[model samples]
Target: MQIAITGTGCYIPSITIPNDDFAANNFLNSDGTPIQHENRLVIEKFKAITGIGERRYVEPHLNTSDIALLAAEKALTDANIDKEELDYIILAHNFGDVSSGQSQSDTIPSLASRVKHLLRIHNPKCIAYDLLFGCPGWVEGVIQACAFIKSGMATKCLVIGAETLSRVTDPHDRDSMIYSDGAGAAVIEAVENGGKILSHATRTFTYEEAYFLFYGTSYRPTAKNTKYIKMYGRKIYEFAITNVPKAMKECLNESGAGIEDVKKIFIHQANEKMDEAIVSRFYGLYDRSMPKDVMPMNIHKMGNSSVATIPTLFDMVRKGNLKNQSIEKEDVVIFASVGAGMNINAVIYKV
Candidate 1:
């Protein structure tokens, strides 16, 4: 069975935070001039170098499921399929609807069930669950969906990677300034032809060196803070430069395809430097074996939507004016991601 992505769609909040607005709100002195060089200055430089103009954030009271529903509806409509046709619904989110509550009940029920009910899908044997990896959660979700379809457990699956990082952000912190809210969905089905997921490879390095960034609950003896994102930039950059290209090579080799066979590379939108490093390493290893291509990145615009990055980019490609660009069937599309858990995953598709 060939598992293919039939449709892709994304939803971003209506409000956009422009760079100037961000700087003014977070980095300006009383005289309206930029403050001295520091962490804030670095973040501003990140915005400028990455060319991210603005990012969206949901309303104060909104949740991840709300953004997800909007994107999911668009995806189903684009695929010419109904939500009732879905056999499985997998949600990948680092931040949930109820994150700090003591209720042991799964958060998926409230969000996913509501979505299914709104679409009028009665008792569809829905599996509403959250997959909590870091940025790579979406790629992991895709791999899991393919496995479910291939195992005859499902015919169609709605895989969503949505995040509301802004909900956990510390407004006073510069790192949190880049974080935004968005959702992306894909309607995947078992198809006889077209793009087929051929190979997947995952690798993990766990140690203090591997621990670069994190956003979650922290246990403290007296008081614990569960809502914040922490990052060690240097360590993250080091890990990305070392691990990402190596993982990509492994996936490419396992698929029996050379780097040249890949038409377009879709990497997790971690950072501009990481993207450039991966591309450079691939070309260095292949030495003219790599194809000249463009990789879409949105880290500057949306910071990191955690798991939503890859699927969101896919949705952007589908909806954007890239239709004028020359792309054809059977061209290999490679998906790669590295996340905070020190986890990395890469997969190839014959699209």
Candidate 2:
């Protein structure tokens, strides 16, 4: 049994906020005054480090599941598949259906369940659930789908990564600059003759660092403070740059492929410098100089949407949304991500 990505789709907000816009509109503290940070310096350093010039945020009325439905609709339509034909809906997210000013998540029915209802998918056999594996959730979902297909347990599956991170972001904090909102979906179906995932690996270091703190954890438990997402950016950057590349190389070796065999790499849009360094280190394993054109980045246009980044970036390149980048048939591509849970995952795929 083989799994082929039949279609891919992503939904980004219409409103694009530039770095200058952030510099102009300062986020005020709880004391009703602007937080202390040199706007010009922060903007400059942020752009220089993250390669982020602009990012998209949805309107106040939109929720997490809304963009998910839109993305799923597009993906299903692109695949020419009907709702009833879907065997599973795997939603990758952290915060679910959180409107503006609401920090708490509503995962009672699961975001995938809400999306199925909103999409009017009434097939009783179609199971829906949520996966919270940090930034690699979407890729992990695809991996799970592959298992289901290859095991002959399912025929078709829809994997989605949708997040409204702006809801939990502390505007007064610098981390807000890296948080955005979006959704991306892919339709995976069993195929006899098509490019498929060859091998993949996932790793987690829950004990090494507690970078992101949520409610009920020992790090932060107070309802008032724990609602917001906080992180040690420096630690995360170091962790990602050191670990992701090594894991990617290991996963590549598992597939009997080399660094030269990869045509492209879609890494999580966390940090520009960090991602570049990771890819460079991966190439360094074989004493090969890093190729500039292999990694396509959209962090300049799309901030870290957590789990949504990989799928969105993949769809963008696959559909010719990016300049001078394209995923053709028979091309070998790699996807990798590292985030919140300090979780890292990589997949070697043939397209």
In terms of lDDT, which candidate is strongest?
2
Question: Candidate 2, TM-score vs. the true structure?
Answer: 0.93
> Which residue segments of model 1 deviate by more than 4 Å?
24-44, 98-110, 209-211, 216-226, 289-292, 322-326
Q: Give me the runs in candidate 2 sitting further than 4 Å from their true place.
A: 24-37, 212-226
Query: Residues 159-195, candidate 1, lDDT per residue (tens digit)?
Result: 8888887667644445566667888998889988867
Error of 2 at 104 (Å): 2.3
Q: Ten-residue segment with the worst summed lDDT in candidate 1?
A: 216-225
TM-score of 1: 0.85
Whole-model lDDT per candidate: 0.73, 0.85
Write one digit per residue (lDDT tens) for candidate 2, span 191-303: 88887888999998888665543422112222255456667777887888888888999999998877778999999998899989999988988789888789988888999
For model 2, what is the alpha-carbon lDDT of residue 68? 92
Clashing pairs in 2: none
